[model samples]
Target: MTVKDSCIVEAGTLLVGVGPDGAMERRYDVGIRVHEGLIAQVGAIEAVAYGNDHLPRYGSRGMIAMPGLVNGHHHFGLTPLMMGVPFAPLELWLPRFRAMRQIGNRLDTLYSAIEMLESGTTTVHHIQSGLTGTPDNWHAITSDILGAYDEIGMRAGYSFMMRDQNILAYEDDAKVLAALPEKVRDWLAPKLGAAATPTADYMDFFRAIRSGWAETSPDGVRVNLAPANLHWCSDESLQLMSQTAREAGASIHMHLVETERQAEYALKKFGHTAVQHLQKLECLGPEVTLGHGNWMTPEDLDIIAGCGCTMCHNASSGLRLGSGIAPVNEMRARQIPVALGIDQSNLADDRDMTLEMKLVWALHRETGLFNDRPDAAAVLQMATEHGAKSAGFGGLVGRVEPGLKADIVLMDEKAMARPFVSKRTPVEETVLHRGGRHAIDKVFVGGRLVVDGGKVISIDREAVMAEVAARLEAPETAAEAADWEMVNAMMPHLEAFHRDHPLVGERRPYRFNRITP
Candidate 1:
């Protein structure tokens, strides 16, 4: 297909992110003009291209146009549940991740990317994980992941997972190894061994990636730094990551306290909360995005807001892994930017941002009072504008306005507003409550049609899914099967350790009330 000079997206209802008063606005019978991969004009159809009707027109009547959804944090690989790993708490689940068989990097990336695109997500903050091997090998893997995104025409932010210590346990690898039986210890040594690359070496590789890809990649691709999580990385490693990110003008994303065990570990190891430790290390800044902050306290929220940092709420992942719900309402009340992410753990087991937005809106409605619930507009912002900023694409692709990248989604208004509500019913409200992947008619990234008629145009989705399914069903080696069995056997011991070391501090409770007694 040849690229055109200009195109028009004509919509019956348009939810523009900004209005004449600099607030979110809704317009009717609007046509958006695209030229050179950016929004050229936005107004009534007559004003955009009146007499000259030769330009390619994209949308049709009964179609609604809005900014493409942004997934603030995600792993560009297969979900663990799909790989035969049952959902467990974060600590127990981390070890089992090693036991899962490795599928080809390209296939896994394309598999997840297709799921995201088909669900109307045009931008993603892809946090790379399971990276191993020498520097050249890492480069090859990273390139392959980014190549898939480039071919699929989705905006992406890439960051490699970095960690130096505590591969298996919060206290020390040696301590955990000592507790296991000799046979089990020997079997896990290779899997949970010391870090293969030094902190300095990881920093060097990060610089190499920036020079090799960030400088020359397309308009939507960026490379950033991820220090994995608080328990997984040492203080020195976190400091280096922060320093490198600041020097390179890159962003940082890390998992904060996602579980009660992790919060307890922070108190035991650092004599403070994880958020405070990061603050002391000078890691809190506007460029930093904390992932799955399920255990953030009120003080932590205040500190995060003061530092100008943001949080990526993975509501489904938290629920799947039994991680407590995040204080999203409190975070918002404090004026901290909270974005939404699938984290490869949605209720539907696919990367559906619409469902994610709906889950975020519904999960936090703790009280039945309408006044204390999250409104449709707030959830939409978290999925779009706030998400864009968290993924380092702020002001570039989250809004449907002139001079901004034309990353947008078109939904069938009739399909969304089914059963015939009054004409005065707000389109945004309908979209948030009733919309799903089936309603997404088309998606555009950089003004290019990536999904049309509920199908991705850039790649063969059925073929890719077929290939991945076959690979997943392939016979596993004895060693691979044995590793999974051993990990399964080891879960009891790990659970005992956590049960003994409960959290000890003035921490927020996961639940507010108990059954009436």
Candidate 2:
């Protein structure tokens, strides 16, 4: 089948971008014209001229046109909860993920991509790491991931997760290994047989990916660096990643203080907060985005804001894992750009950015009335503009304007605007309060229709799901079964270790309510 350079037009109530005074502007009966995958014109329908008179037109009525959602931080397309990995702190949960069986890479990626697109997510920052394989193995896996996104027609930023030390605990791996029982230790030997690949090798693989797969497109995929987390990566690894990203003109994303335990680890290991350590390494900049800043202090916020770095708030992930609420309001107060992400752990256990946005909107309203909180517009920006910027697509595909990539979502206005009353509710407010996958009428990326009629258009959803289901039903390998047993035995011991070795410094207030005697 030959792909043609086509033109398309979409007309609806257009929620545009920030105005000169920094307020969101909305216009009714506006039309956007897409030519060769880029937005050509945005204005009154009558004023806009299309190069092709027979081009397709969509969302003529009862629809709202807005920028496509961007998932600022995500992992593989699959969710751990679906595979029997329950909610635990991020540190403990990491091991559980290892025990889960691996399905085909392409199928797993498409599974999440379809869900994301149906929920109006056109772009994602996928943090990939810790896969057990040689460079060739990694190449094949990364190729499969990128291929899936290419077929599904979604933009993605692929960041290879980098870590070198402390694979099991905040302290030395020897200590953690010594603490395990003999049976558990033997079972884990095969899984943890090799030391981490040399940092130079990781850099070489990254260069290979950058040259081969990181092609330039208005709404295509790019590769970035991810230093996994503070406790996982050594200082040398972090420095190498920072320098490589800087030299390559790519972005970096890392987890910082996702939980109180991680905060404690930072103080215990580095003599400072995680954010301060990043600052000390000179890693904070416009191109760096710190994921899950739940335990960031006011001083940390100042440093983040001062450095022009961004933060991604994974609201449902925090709640699901019992991580503390991210201080999004405080970050915004400090003029730090805060974006939204699902982090593969939304309340629904699916990739739904609309629901994630609503959760973010509701999660940070702790202050009394009259205190500034995230309104609908603010949350919308986090899901769209700020999110796009966080994924390294700044000013590229997040707004409905000429010269931007035509990555847009058309929502069913009728579904969102149901139960009509005398006073008309604003479209943005209605979307934030009521919108979900059911309300998504269509999604377009780079002027190509990727989803329509509440279904993804480019791939066979049913076939993908069926294949994955069949693969998952097959019996696990002996290694996998052994790892599962090891995880079960390790959980209690790991929990006890954390409980007994609490932070030495003054601890912060409890993130959630504790049962009192």
- Give the 10-residue window scoring lowest on summed lDDT in candidate 2: 508-517
Clashing residue pairs in candidate 1 are: none
Clashes of 2: 0
Would you estimate the TM-scores of all the predictions? 0.94, 0.94
lDDT of 1 by residue, 204-290 (tens): 988888887756564767788999889889888899899999998888989888787787778788888899999999999999999
* Candidate 2 error regions (>4 Å): 1-5, 49-51, 193-195, 216-218, 421-424, 476-479, 504-508, 511-517
Candidate 1: global Cα-lDDT?
A: 0.82
Structure candidate 2, residue pairs in collision: none
lDDT of 2 by residue, 1-517 (tens): 0122345555568888655454667988877888778898888776664345677877775788889999998888667877889877777788888688888788889999989999999999988755566888888888888888888888988887777777877767767777788887776666665546888788888887887765433248778888889988888888888898889888888988888778878888878888899889887899899998888878888999999999999999888887878888888888788889899758989989999988988887775878788778889988988888888889887899998988889998778767662336667788788888888988888888888999998888889888888888888888878878879998888777766656645654655311110
Model 1, which residues run further than 4 Å from truth?
A: 1-5, 18-23, 368-372, 500-509, 512-517
Provide the overall lDDT of each model, using Cα atoms, as 2-decimal numbers: 0.82, 0.81
